[model samples]
Target: MMRYTLNKMLLRLQNRYNYDVRYQQDLLQTDLAAFLKFMAFQSMSSHQGNLAAAPLYAARLRAIIFEDCGPCTQLVVNMALEAGVSAAMLRAIIEHDLHQLPEDIALVVQFTELVLAHQPQADLLREKIMALWGSKGLMAIGFAISSYRVYPALKYALGYGKTCSRIQLNDASLVPNRAAVVAAEAQNVE
Candidate 1:
């Protein structure tokens, strides 16, 4: 039997995922095998260059949202914003207004949602993605969406999850109801 300390586990997670994993760190405390398996899945899904960053971020955001992992959702949002995704686009995604995004990103989001929901449209969407991004790209997208599903289930089942909330990005804060904030700003300007 092997024992893993919290510090070592946190360091490993930070190195691999590049973010805090404290939200589900108890998985390490209780089931090291499950925790390592989740980490491995994440690593496998993290292959780069198969798809554009923007569309990949959009798909990942949709996946985390569908999985209902509040902390994970906020983390991805912050990461995307930091990686140069426009705040407006992130807001649109959070609101499920895919029409506001570019066609490719919108398609990726729609595909992610359908796949996460196990809807029949997922197959058709997969075909479209294959056409647009080729087989390698489609495979990467599928890996990302499916692998991201692991965290929310683990977090929720282990009593480590919460409802999504505002997240900070760079020096700015990302609120859940950004539309309301924009409306308020407009009224103030009038």
Candidate 2:
């Protein structure tokens, strides 16, 4: 009975988001306890902790994009849209149009990239984040960047991850800029 209920809930989420949750379904079928624990991580990923929709989604989309360019990235994009992030801003992020992004979003993107790259330069941006949104804001960004990567990693580990695909925002079909990711990785290697 619990399994049936959970399956229904997963179906609802898949339908609502137009996303593939097959990895989650596999987890549920193979290990109910792990499934529950995995699902519980949503709370950690979603603790906004006083973040406004823009900066919060900025961090989320950036982090997810770094980790995935396929369905998982699309999922975050859709959620960000539902959360009221402007399509233009989202387009800027995905397209890597740094010049076009709004100030706060640009800051979050820079910070997210630095942190993900494990670069000490993030410290300066961290200070900027603290000045703008305080520790709660910093915590929210931290959770978003760290937790959003888990879904794609789990999907790949379970053999359910897909290759990069075009991301759609409203009527616009945008390709994620892999150059930034490649550049970040190159920096890590240096």
Q: Count the backbone clashes (under 3 Å) in each candidate.
A: 0, 0
lDDT of candidate model 1 versus the reference: 0.69
Off by over 4 Å in 1: 1-20, 167-190
The estimated TM-scores of all candidates read: 0.74, 0.93
For each candidate, the alpha-carbon lDDT, in order, equals 0.69, 0.84
| C-alpha lDDT (0 to 100) for residue 101 of candidate 1 | 84
lDDT of 1 by residue, 1-190 (tens): 3445645767785775466676546666667787677667767657645787788887777787776666787778767776788887887777667569887877787777766656666677677788999998887888778877777777777777776666554455654432332233223221
Best by TM-score: 2
Superposed by TM-score, candidate 1 places the C-alpha of residue 72 at a distance from the truth, in angstroms, of 1.0
Worst 10 residues of 1 by lDDT: 181-190
lDDT of 2 at 111: 83
Best by lDDT: 2
Candidate 2 off by > 4 Å: 181-190
